[model samples]
Target: MNVTLTLALFIAAWALLDYLKPQFVANLEDNILSFLLAIITLVSFGQVVARYGFNTGWSAALEFNMLAFSWLILFGMSYGIRTRLHLGVDILLQKVGPQTAKMLGIFGGLLGAFYALIILDGAVLSIVGVDKEGGAITYFAKMYKVGIGVEEMKYPAFVQEMFGLKRPHVQRWVVLLILPISLGLLAYRCLQASWHIYTGQCGSLIAGHEAESLVEENRGALKD
Candidate 1:
């Protein structure tokens, strides 16, 4: 849920920036969130020290890893979308006339959909594996039942369960639950990009310099 919120915030911020400021948006369009996350990791280290004194539980490492992955994917995808660089065909499409370009775009989208399905399949398998293995980190294995709702410590509930205790128990890979949905969104975007190309419409959601280039292209096409 924390990862979900982090991703949501990043996307919302990305959308807002795309709406409000288009030119200067390139700064965050690349790696701002990564740097912010690095700062968060540094701060979390202090919190880890404060919470467990010298212990600094290993669970924090797992928790932080999840956070890092969540932010990286969220913001990285935002950057990719903004730049029109999400495994797309830009140069080849540009060389062709509008009709053929549009056809190729639709083909690209269908291809992307197939690839997304493969990724979704892998994600489902990985999630199932997590559930089957009932994996718990070393910290949880060591002090599982010892602490539960004691303070706002960041550890999986399964860790508590392993130690003969109970806490909030969602599925093991609950953090990754939204991944399928995000992949679905990626597929949808591919379809949308294809549609925009076919219809000779620059997509409303295309952002940053990509949006500017799209607008300029449309204008130039209208002149021709």
Candidate 2:
């Protein structure tokens, strides 16, 4: 058994667990975000200290930090929706009655899903080059065949040999895969919110602090 391939397969197993247990997936996303954040902070701090105090730093530090930031933002987009952390302007929603607000929220969810679908389509097309014959092919396959690699921080020779890779550099396609994954997650959450609203399990698709709370607080302040 190839140890490298086995390690990759083990990592991929998390996707299966995501489908089987959504809560597990949610926790996984949170943990991944936290780890990325920590890495970014530590690396950036080290880079600063090395540049100023030691008069030296890793040349690839900026590139690695950028990659980490991109991953965090992309993954956090879906996590925000899942945890109802996304801010929404709900003035109109609050003005309406419960039934009307719920219906409008469902409509908004559909629109969000549609927007994500459009983004996903464009990203996929960009990643996978089109054939002259107008045939479509998988981007991952093309990337693998070409052995594309990142400009900086190439993988070690041993890792390349273990994976039978022609290039020692990190694969660009692997990072690009986050585009589809995050978009898919966002679309799924949009549909989920719509369903919840339809079933009366959720009052609104846009989650935020209720307007009534602000009004109540203001009234209490006036009395005081």
Best by TM-score: 2
lDDT of 2 at 145: 65
Please give, for residues 73-185, the per-residue lDDT of candidate 2 as tens digits.
Answer: 87787677667667778888778888888889899887777666556544433434732221111344455467677778677778888889776668876766666566666
Model 1 Cα lDDT, one tens digit per residue, 1-224? 24325544654565477558857666654456667577667767776786679755554455555655675675465355435655532666556786775676577666665555445443433533532222122223333333333323344666766776445533334444445445544555555566666676653223434655767879978788
lDDT of 1: 0.53
Mark the regions of model 1 whose C-alpha exceeds 4 Å error after superposition. 1-59, 74-79, 82-89, 121-171, 203-224
Candidate 2 structure lDDT = 0.70
Cα RMSD (angstroms) for every candidate in the order listed: 11.3, 6.8
Screening candidate 1 with a backbone cut-off below 3 angstroms (N, C-alpha, C), the clashing residue pairs are none
For candidate 1, the C-alpha RMSD (Å) to the true structure equals: 11.3
Clashing pairs in 2: none
Cα deviation at 127, candidate 1, in Å, is 24
